[model samples]
Target: MESGGWTIKKRSNSSNDSLSREYVAETGCLSIVVLGASGDLAKKKTFPALFNLYRQRFLNPDEGHIFGYARTKISDDELRNRIRGNLVPGKGASGEQLEEVSKFLQLIRYVSGSYDSEEGFRLLDKEISKHEFSKNTKEGSSRRLFYLALPPSVYPSVCKMIRNCCMNKSDLGGWTRIVVEKPFGKDLDSSEQLSAQIGELFDEQQIYRIDHYLGKELVQNLLVLRFANRFFLPLWNRDNIDNVQIVFREDFGTEGRGGYFDEYGIIRDIIQNHLLQILCLIAMEKPISLTPEHIRDEKVKVLQSVLPIKDEEVFLGQYDGYTDDPTVPDNSNTPTFATMILRIHNERWEGVPFILKAGKALNSRKAEIRIQFKTVPGDIFKCQKQGRNEIVIRLQPSEAIYMKVTVKQPGLEMSTIQSELDLSYQQRYQGVTIPEAYERLILDTIRGDQQHFVRRDELKAAWEIFTPLLHRIDNGEVKPIPYRPGSRGPEEADQLLERAGYVLTHGYSWVPPTL
Candidate 1:
């Protein structure tokens, strides 16, 4: 499961090693261009994130502006309306807040542009340049950031257009960067091609390969939980852990949005990139430093140790009535649910099975990583009766980290029950607003922090791990089973877990933080 002809060459992309994080963040006048501005992703995520950052003053209103570029021809007011519809001013926003929204709208401007054409990009460059000239001419240099909210089909052309017409390469005091979302590519070859396209125009530092899942609060805390807390240090390997499961389930189906969902399936959509990235963080050797490269370096090392997934270990399923959606093909076998076991071939995780399961249209929408430990060697209580210690890192529906430990029952009887040591976001951070994953990630991009972003070499290694399995599913070598719409998943998923020695214990589920 390794990529050939692409020898690993790690290059730091920092333009100025002298620039401090604070300086990089606060010194420049920033301009953000959302490529697919009129679309759902821009309205639902990109614009809302910029608005929040502006509202909080992380992005200086005077020094910042947002440009919306898309093929849709719309007036500035119409574009603002699209953005405002998604930006709920919250429960009881103040008049000042309302005014801020109005002011933020002023900073937003729209331009109808073709993704592949230089003419439109030149027009976009003009709009961006106006703002750059407006900033203190003698002081801070203007920065340019492009957010590709459009489809991957247009990335190559759009990237070329940006480099040709929009980059501010002369601004040594400032910087230029672009943020791209995943499915990085269709598979290994396509991903490499996309990487090559981006690499040609932008340096590693200038490219932000975004995986919003990594921006999650709990995900970010993995470092502190593993290194800062001594409880997990010695017990984080196969010596203590029985198995690991990264499970993501959505209570609602894509419905009309099956067009995108069907094209990629569960593996490409969630498992390959998101879940595998989480696995790397959970299994990596302790990094030498908290530097972004050091952390990413360790993450890449973990991926290199992963063995290719065996098709026999894969369980794929399609939900009932999935074809009812017009977007999905009538005879499509694209899997809505998939569960696969990945084995890491290194000493720490040699025999440990890292199971990743993701599905849509289930009973509840939740994401969590469950680590089940091996049985106690000499237990006073029956080994089966004694609950093996389990750690759960919940990513959504409420972020939380909790451990289920066996404790003596309150009654006179010496029976045992599971009790939790938990850290729930809501309970701990009173009256605080943890920004959405997009918000945190967008802010990180603005601040030039690449720690959470994926790198080309890392992405290539990830694709190498799953490309063969993808080819099997793509070529109809394996057929997807059918499951009920609201069920957890196919019954075979449960069977697969049992065969892998992962216990689906009952009578204990952590209460999530109040949303």
Candidate 2:
């Protein structure tokens, strides 16, 4: 129950070749069933990630098996071919590893069944039994993991089937975990209802709510940067900080997935899941232990403590002609751009505004967090007031960390200028392929490291913070401001920060370059 540090249990029979390999092997032989496995998510991310894990020998000798369930019927050979096509064995993967991966992919079994049908589930059970018998993995009951990679609408029914056929009938001693992806629900009420339904079949501890952003090395390093170093611990609060900015922007429009984009838009897609998760990491109080519960508890507190945003402080917008996309329905009010300022009502962050902005179809592409610090109150830098000191964590394109501080110019005029102590990943680390977010997450799930996984209460609190705004949007009380296709969102977004007494670090530029 202690949550201060990581709790790793040793598996008696399983071991890896090396410490690094051990990290993978300790997960034990896993029987993974990816529902909707033939879908885009499965092809693009899931299979490729699993292959990476396999290449690392994270699996056992009788180490692995993946089941793909969908309405379409496909042979194992075809599934292997499909998986191989998506994999990029560019680096960190050898020809032998690719051959092994292909061999492992042959272990993938596909099931064709409707989600709501009893016969479908009965058939699914048959497939599981077939894999178990084929692999002769009956020495000890292997772990069974169900990854619901389908849309949220189908989630409840799929979960119900799993409960009726899979969880109820399957052997209980071995670990059974279910992974649910986002957006977990449309709003707070839906989120709570979904949580209750999931809790019915799976305990909170057994459910692994996946938020891919948390799996990134840079994101996880945030904890190390704050807790591991003495330099940052003292200055990480309102006393020395000015404000925080979290931005996730995209240059391309909906890309013809407009129907799907219109339903949730930027708020639910990015701000609710990605941006808020990042904010919690930046704002949370240190947990007493590293248990999923403790870390999530701290994260939930940060989310719950985020004071409600006033109408004037929150801004929403839709890109021009967004509703005109063929896939979008008529009169769609979904916003493609959202910017809101939150005031955390906690001792460490009281009165400090955490500005969150996320939008699609912006100028440039970026996902970054900027932490700004207040200037030395009324002292030395009055004559050279440039801007607040900042630490920017760039999450994509070129992953890097930069700190802005005042440094003296080479010439001896006693004049000081601000410069960045930059740590660029692309520059500093050479010839190393930064593993994809999916790669890390899939591996973490196998390792049972819940530090990067979202907890139940954290999900609830996140929805609570944005519930009011969501309600307003549903009721048509807030109309989205329109911005150009190739710009940095609406003018109101600029005004939102300007009114907060903060300025954009790079003026009002496009979020990313247009494709």
Local distance difference test values of all predictions, in order = 0.84, 0.78
Relative to the true structure, candidate 1 reaches a TM of: 0.93
For candidate 2, give the lDDT.
0.78
Deviation of model 1 at 175, angstroms: 1.2
Give the deviation of candidate 2 from the true structure as CA RMSD. 5.2
Give the Å shift of residue 68 in candidate 2. Answer: 0.6
TM-score of each: 0.93, 0.89
Candidate 1: residue 133 lDDT (0-100): 71
| lDDT (tens digit, per residue) of candidate 1 on 330-439 | 98889999999999999999899999999998888999999999987878676455457899998887878899888777998878787788888888888999887888
Q: Write the per-residue lDDT of candidate 2 for residues 115-134, one digit (tens) a residue.
A: 99878888877777666556
Give the CA lDDT, 0 to 100, for residue 472 in model 2: 92
Model 1 is weakest, by summed lDDT over 10 consecutive residues, at 1-10
